[model samples]
Target: MPKRTATMLGCAVLLGMLMGESRAQTDDPSGSPGAGRATVWIEPSVSVGATLSSNGNASSSNGRSELMLDVTPALRAVLNTARVKGFVDYSLRAEYFLDGNSGNRLSNRLNASATVEAWDQRAFVDVSGSISDQSVSAFGPQNLTGLADVNRSETSSFRVSPYIRGTLGGLVDYQVRYALQTLNTDTSIRSDSTSQVLSARLGSRPVGQQLGWFFDASAQENDYVIGRDTRSDIARAGVIVSVSPQLNVTLSAGVETNDTITLQRESYNITGLGFDWRPSLQTSLSVSVEKRYFGTGYNASLEHRTGRTIWRYSASRSASDSPTQAGSVRLGTNYEIVDALFAQSIPDPILRAQAVLQFLANFNIPADAQNFQDFLSSSATLNQTQRLSVALNGIRGVITFNVSRGTTSRLDSLTTLGDDFDSNTEIDQQSWGVSYGHRLTPLTSFNAAYIDQKSSGSSGISSKRQSVSLGLSTRLAPRTSGSVQLQFGRFNNTAGSYNDAAISGRITHRF
Candidate 1:
């Protein structure tokens, strides 16, 4: 299918299903807002700024200095109804260089997701989409600023999932789900692809029993616009036991067949063990281990919250084939981190989210700056990743810290041109960041932050980038604000090294 036609078809299907479901439900008789009726929020804002950069092109050596003007108009919309929940944040940024040394540019950024209960307790649908700037190559030049660069490209992806659930005469509970996803990029270095997954599960429906069992099956296929298609199928059966009020254990055996490693399909036995532990309301731990066709795979995570702090840690190793899944790994933003930290104190999810957003905005913190991102690839890979994060809130200040490391190894021998795995067998990436914000006055705030990232390929290519910044923000008036920032950065790699310095001021008005 053509790209544009596929996009339109996906949108039409999502809209038709959502509209059909909306007509089937009636308004709540209680007359209370958000109970059954739709509650919507729309926020629009614009910002203008001028920046002076010592290195505008982000070149490795002998870069030219330039002065640029930037204007960004952004909108955030949130919808809440008895049957649907969704939100979208979008921005359009325009840049013009005053020195005539570089051409003008325009870019778009968006993030959105929605879930609809189409058939009340039996059927549902999920839709999500995103457009963002990302690096095309892991070995290319790296930068701290969100400026236009030759190595960066606009990437977008969409997913639609619809599923049904019910029970069979008080004997077993079952669910069947189908998901379709598409990925595209502005640059030719990365391949656009579509993925389809169909999965089903049947489990014993127990009222108060301590033991249960389940059967699972799934088939997945991925087709690339540039390379050969890949497919996989798996079937499994598992038994679950409640060890105690706070712990549960599961054991499973299965078989999987796939053509990811070679042209011919191969079969392998699968064995797995897993446990979930939630000793208290403030903590949770989950661990799973499995022996698969590629190798031994495992996942573990721990989360704990205190009155004024939160800590999270996770580690995992698995085989990944779809670029959409690989690129979706995220460490979240400052707002999300702080929101999770306040869950113990605030209890209410909606209230906590609003409070966190307000607090970050007041302190001039960048709420959308993620700690790490992965480059896109078409070939299959064995990926191992680890992440740790913590947030602390005090009476007059807030601090957050995050760190992550990951390694990707080629799983297939086929040489896909322009793929990261084409020349190197393995790639390693690591990043860490820390930020502090303090209330200087009732209406003014101060913030400081530092971030560092490093990447290395087994083929003897490596790059490192570091940045430090300070800023101050104050409320100019109602629905208006102004801020100023100063930043310095350093970049080094096998090619060369460069240093950058920048200062900028901006004003924003909300409506």
Candidate 2:
């Protein structure tokens, strides 16, 4: 598909069906004639599948036996109004081979977001976008299915922000923001970027003050279509010490300037400390530390809850220049860490994102596979991450587990021609996964999963992957559904070792 991407996806589906039928025939200035207070939700689906492979073209030498054909169309939507909020999920797939020796494909997936409240509660606007099928070489060739096309690629991202916040008579607290971000790929194998940021803040008023104060400033720029252009700035000030009533603390200092690793412009000195603790109501903790100029940075998190479980932990280190968030350079999943552990039991963000997509569709889970795997970088990097996850949710069963580790390096040494930190100065990764479903009744359901990944580079290059899946899903009427699956995968590197096995089936219909 490319006749200008199918005419720009048919003019964005006819401009989103004429702006959703002109916003459902607009009207509703607080109601009356055609009283509308817009609300729209739509679900559309279509799927057809077939797959039988031993190595359908992800060939690692004389591997053949292909039978693939799959078609998919999907959409999920939500929009609510009074001042708008929106969400969308989209999909598209087409694959066909039937032994024509592999090749005939198209893929797409998207996640979208929107928010607008133009002047209510102090002006706002935010937008988001995503598309995926990454890995343009983090040591190339790795797969776990999307039906083969190994060494992946198809990345997209977008973001927009506009902001203003108020409170100056409630004794100081203010905000100002601006953001723009972008990333794209259709293959140039990485390098396409744009980022801009402007920020402001002034604070005080930590619930009837106990010694509070704040000041913050920001500036950032990253522009690359082929590298070179990075700038950063920061300013700070702080104090907020309520050391009790469940704790609070902070202290900060300022100054920063950058060029992201030389070619002039370097200035530093910034210090920080942060804290917050919640002692109960199911536990919480937060932490922060900073002493920048690439040396010491930190952010920490912990959350706990039980009565059917949810536990999470996090750790971080900064400076990852844009790919529009998500552990920068795209990372974060297990369905956004169990939808942020169901935010204190679904505190409505559209019903906690539809109860985390019906709890990952009753655990046939693979909302982008238990996290961490993103590659394609163009300068500006420095990260260190850690994760731990757990989820339970029972009755008819659900379980999940996760583990993670990360490291990356290169904060630009002035465009070291063509990515991967110009021959790995650093790169290390690790991942883990486990899943189970079980609800063999109420219209079937039983699933299983296992995952693993490993990577290393410091110019010694390395790679590894493993996957296993089992599935069964039912409900064959009332807008139909069906599924069947068996899969296996393995990959290794130092340049060799590959394995695969598969069986698949699908049927879906909905409107």
Worst 10 residues of 1 by lDDT: 323-332
Show the colliding residue pairs in model 2.
none
lDDT of 1 by residue, 1-511 (tens): 5643565376557645544544454456677877653354557899998888888778765787878899999976555556776666678999989987677888888776677788868998877777788788777776556554677888887777789999999889999998877788889877888878899999998566689999999999988887778899999999999888788899999999999888888999999999999999989999999999988999999999888889999999999877665323221478678878777777644455457667887888876788876787766679999999898989889989999999998777765657777878899999999999999998999999999999899999998889999999998998888999999999888899888888889998888
In order, the Cα lDDT scores of the candidates are 0.81, 0.75
Task: Please give the lDDT score at residue 63 for candidate 2.
Answer: 70
Q: After superposition, how far is residue 252 of candidate 1 from its true place, in Å?
A: 1.2
lDDT of 1: 0.81
- Backbone clash pairs for candidate 1 read none
Q: What does the lDDT read for residue 469 in candidate 1?
A: 96
**Local error of candidate 1 at residue 221 (angstroms):** 0.8
Report the number of clashing residue pairs per model. 0, 0
Each candidate structure's TM-score, on Cα atoms with residue i matched to residue i, is 0.92, 0.34
